[model samples]
Target chain A: DVKVTQSSRYLVKRTGEKVFLECVQDMDHENMFWYRQDPGLGLRLIYFSYDVKMKEKGDIPEGYSVSREKKERFSLILESASTNQTSMYLCASSSSGAGWGEQYFGPGTRLTVT
Target chain B: ELKVEQNPLFLSMQEGKNYTIYCNYSTTSDRLYWYRQDPGKSLESLFVLLSNGAVKQEGRLMASLDTKARLSTLHITAAVHDLSATYFCAGLMEYGNKLVFGAGTILRVKS
Candidate 1:
């Protein structure tokens, strides 16, 4: 079975603090993504990595960065935490095959910034 | 830019009823996906529609795609309390592996 695990299920941080959220997958997928889920905005992509050390910015990449140094690990970094950045973070992994394969998601991390 | 839209952002229904969630995309895409998410939980893969007229069913949920219309529908038959969750539909762009997702429909089923 494929499993994606997040570093923390809930987090709290103060403003101006630097925060890091980690994600690990056991499926050995080539594509990994980070998304933030808000009430009305739905799931907005923050960043994605297709290969180790290769990252791409998504629609809502501002104030967020990602690192993929290993195949099974992807990390999201918040340079400066703010109240507006408090949202549920999700990590997903998918295969890099020809067709559109389903993405497996982690349990998500709920971050609160004060 | 490709945009995905879903109708009826919130749905409330009683058990044993039937409902359909609609998802439309702004651009042409051959691959579509459906996902279900519980409150405070991550999303789970429900269906993947690859081509036009493609239909897949599992248990009480059925999903179909129409590439020409750029539309996909997730129809629920005999809904139950377990089916209460947020459903999202995403469109795979023609060029890249990025997926554009709709704003999800929140479903509530009452007994």
Candidate 2:
């Protein structure tokens, strides 16, 4: 099984506080992605990492950043968390092989910015 | 810009009934994907349609893609409560690096 794990299942942070969400994948996939899910908007990509230390912005990457210092780990950073940033965060990893970018997702972290 | 649209963002079905969710894309795409996300849970990859007229099925859910029409459909047969979830369809754009997802269809299967 491709196991993707997140650091926290639920988190609460004060507005303007810095928040970090960690994700780790066991399958040695070369690609990692962070997404935020809202009620009617569905899942929007925040950031994605193709290789270690390589990052790319997705659709909604203004308030968020990401890090990939290691192959198995990826982290999402919120510089100044706001109430609007409170959403379910999902981490996904995919192999660069014939899988053709099939993403396997973690259980997701529900972040509440108060 | 690449845009993906899904019709009937919400669906309610009774057990043993059947329905189909539609996904359409603006730009040309050779690949389409389907995912299922349960309440408060992350998404699970359901099917990957890599070509025109491609169809894949698992359990009671089946997905088909038509590259010519830039459309994909997820058909549910004999719906059950376990099939209730938010279904998302994404299309791989030209560069193939990013995926544009639809608004998603929330399926509620009733007893």
How large is the i-RMS for each model, in angstroms? 1.2, 1.2
lDDT of 2 by residue, B59-103 (tens): 999999988888899999999999999999998777755678899
DockQ for all models: 0.75, 0.72
- Candidate 1 DockQ score? 0.75
Off by over 4 Å in 2: none
Name the top lDDT candidate: 1
Q: Which candidate is the best by DockQ?
A: 1
The docking category that best describes candidate 1 is medium
Residue lDDT tens for model 1, B1-111:
788999989999999999999999998885899999999899998999988999999999999998888889999999999999999999877776788889999999999
Residue A80 CA displacement from its true place in model 1, Å: 1.5
